[model samples]
Target: MDLNQMLSEIEGGNDEEIERLLQRYNSENNRTFTFDQKEESLRIKLCQSTLAVLRREVPFSCQRTCLETLRIMSRDKCVLSPVATREGILTLSLSQNGLQEDNLSEEEERVVVEALKCLCNVMFNSPTAQQICVDVQLAPVLCGKLHSADTWHHEVGLFTLRLLFLLSALRPDLRMCLRKDCQAVTLLTKMLEHTLDINWWLTFTAENNERVMEALKALFNLTLNEPEGEEDVRQCRVIVSLLRHVLMLKTETVEKTEELHSHAVNLLNNLPVSCLDGAGRPACASASENLKVKPEIGNTMRNKLVRLMTHVDWGFDIMSGCEEEPRPNPSEDMTEEQKEYEAEKLFKIITELTRHDMIRPMVVRPDGQLGSLEDKLREIANDDDEANNSDSD
Candidate 1:
């Protein structure tokens, strides 16, 4: 049956029609499921029917189907206006009581996950929905959900982290609220450590990797453009340490490993220089060695020096080898422009690393089998000069 017919039947209290429609929609390729602007009335009717189904006591399967359908429909901005209303947001946002309880059945959990996914799409595509989220104080509620141990589930935590990231990214006021008021930094860092299994041992399963990546993205958003206070610095230290572990994790493929590292590096770039003492330490040895040594400024600076030098060396290797051995897969290769951009980011980071007293020696070390930071910087400068000369010619 067509969506119009199914939705009409749904409004007539035939919940089974919604499930059939949902199955049909799910079977079709999602890319083909566009909600055209011309179909505004149909979209509105569909939204009303779904929300109505959610408001009434229906089978959990029916509710989930309605929510899942809405989640797909909300991807289109044209359909979002009707779905972004206060009533719509409230109906879709999982009930605080339901989320708080640990004994929820699998069917009930599926409904909650679908609801959160729907909210994510709504918040992502509509400013109206974002403001409504704030008006309803959704950020604190999400934080509270994460804060409670009972409410934790893999899918629930992942989507919740995603929603929190969107709120922090889209709204400036909520960043501080998430940071100071919600204590999101500490909470997210703990989540990352848990996913990484940092305390017990490193565990790099796909599920945990995805959760850690979302937590990292959210952390990057939360810390963006915010000045670090003493408390913030302390929290950042713990995060950087966890991120160090993230860097060392070997995923199933080289590309996946690089992707994870890229996220880790982006977050590291935002952190304060003081907090980066944790970043420079050897990822594998950090947990044990940290327990053995009392942290001092000298040791911290030395670690930073070694870490910066390591980055410089790694950057040099990539730059030198890019031409000698072209990657077999053209799609996987970094473009020259992208390589240059990454090089610029590295230069900026290395430059910042040099501001400390201990980092100076590493930068100026003489070129040899173990190349120095100065040599890498000089090589990068010569390459830039050659590129500029060629462009001018």
Candidate 2:
């Protein structure tokens, strides 16, 4: 049937026809299903019908199919305007009422997962959807759902984390809400520990790794532009410890390790520097001794920070030495812009480390063989002066 005819039948309350049309559209192998941009009215109608089906007391199969179809359709930004509405968001979000109750059957869990997937797609593609998500206060609801241990092991938890990441990344207000209202830093930290199996023995699997990555990303967004209140400082200390564990994780490959470490670094860079006094110190001697944290974990973190500082120093040396080498085109591996950005983060981190009386000794080893942090800062200042002089010339 044509798109209009199918949507018409769905609007006419033909439940079987609606299920068939949704299945056909949502099929992975069905390459023939494509919605024309001109048929926007039909798309809106389709979203409305699917949302209605989700709201109705439909069978699990029907509800699942509707959610899956909405997920696929939401990929097109054009179809998202209607889906981004307040009512539309609530209908899809509330479809998983079982999630709030912590008593979902297997079938109900499937529907909830699909609903979350749809919500993720919608929120990702539409800023309107993102704003509406904040207005509807969906973060607290998702946070509440995440409190359940059962949700952590399932796709529901993963999608919920993904949604939270998108929401916080896109909406600054939601980040504060998550950090203050949801206590997301601690929640996500616990989730990270759980995913890494830190309490027991470490279990390195692809599934847990992705979960860890998502949790790290969400934590990064939550901590961005955060003020350093007493509570924030305490929370950051805990995160610094968790990041040390992340750096020490054994991924399947060197490349995977680097990728995960890059994310961990980005998050570590976002944390307030005041809380970093304990970053380079040993954790085993502290109160966490009861947790059996290895002493080397702290050393690993220290070494990682020093390596980044050294990398930044080396980059500056090369730039100063090769004054005549025409700046090369930005490459996929590390663009010139990205190099400067990374160097800046490393410089700031190292500069902050130098302020700590104890950390300064570890970070600034002045044996005359390695340049001190002060020397690097002077070199950076000289380079800036040279750039300004060259621009004036």
Candidate 3:
């Protein structure tokens, strides 16, 4: 196959021809060439052709095929170099144009989805491409996509947001830009709350679980080291929402629940540490004042967490209506794996909660009607020590 000539044909071809070319490239069974320099050069040419077609005022169908081709081409790192080049990034203008249209055909919408995915692929580990995206004012376009009523739009929006978040971690300019955009903060926070919804518990799949975790991670990244960002997060009540998410995780299997629990704790830890301001200042004498939590709300959340910490077991057992006496050996029936996982999550959550002044007392109080959370920690520590001793003997 004359790949360069084929790419040229695809770029200028009619809609039917473009679709045929895209399908040919998309089909794995049709691939027979070795992954040598020739093949790499072919992929790079295809990326160029895809961008050229996208940049032109073509039929929407041709544009859609162009995006599909770009997506396929983006999978190879050699192709990605061309895709992120100055000429290649101009295709983002086309993507922005299509996404701005209020009325798009199903095919055009599909193209939009693929375009976002292609953008994600092109920018992966490519800081130059990420900068190009920011230079082109892509964040606002992505933030706009998040507001669409369509679920496909939301899904791709999240995928793109995940990429942007990764980029922001290494690019302080992008991070500040996102932090200054109130819309970005609002959208990310709303996504977090929606993913943390109880409805997800009933309709959960591994895919949705992963998406939720990604959303949390993105939100965490957005809030990192920015006092204004943290304030925006506080207004969203993410602290309370994440706590609810932790409670909901009890419904998952032990391994899955522990994974989600770790993410939840990370998000909690990402919240602005009350003792330290953005400039690393701890001038505030009252830690409670730094938290910005209303007294009643703080007490309520503290009480909920206190209950979580002292519970004999996780999940439904914590909510069981039967008032059975506390087990003398709660760890007896649990496998060593389950015991370690359970203890780690509990300790992490308590440690994060104690960072706030209003919650610290409940966490560290030495006495309680049914033993303090501190008592539970001591018991877990003793069990770990005894287990280690048994192993040695």
Question: How much is the lDDT of residue 89 in candidate 1?
Answer: 87
lDDT of 1 at 49: 72
Backbone Cα, N, C clashes tallied per candidate? 0, 0, 0
**Quick one: ranking by TM-score, best first?**
2, 1, 3
Off by over 4 Å in 1: 25-33, 95-97, 149-151, 198-203, 226-228, 281-393
Q: Which candidate ranks first by TM-score, i.e. highest?
A: 2
Per-candidate TM vs. native?
Answer: 0.68, 0.69, 0.59
lDDT of 3 at 356: 64
What does candidate 3's lDDT look like per residue over 1-393, in tens digits?
567778778767876787677777667523432345667877777776667666667766776667766766666666578777666676754674456435656776666767767777778746678788777777776666556523544445456666656665556566666767736666766665665563555734555566666666666676676456456646446454554555455434656655665666566666645522342223433653432322223334343343334334432244432244456888889999999999999988887888763464435444323445677788889999999999999
Q: Which candidate should be chosen as best, given lDDT against the real structure?
A: 2
On a 0 to 100 scale, what is the lDDT of residue 305 in model 2?
47
lDDT of each: 0.73, 0.74, 0.62
**Model 3 regions lying over 4 Å from their true place:** 1-5, 8-13, 29-34, 59-61, 100-105, 148-154, 198-210, 226-233, 250-259, 272-393
Note the residue pairs that clash in candidate 2: none
Q: lDDT by residue for model 2 over 1-393, one digit each (tens)? A: 367887777877666777887898778523534567787787788888788787787788888899888887887787787789999999888886455446667878888888889889888889888888888888888777656634454677777888888888877777777888888887887777666664334535666667777888898898887665888888888888888778778676766766678788889888877777856655543553332222223446554444443233322343222123456665558978889998899888887876774454323445434545666788779999999999999
Weakest ten-residue segment in model 2 by summed lDDT: 314-323
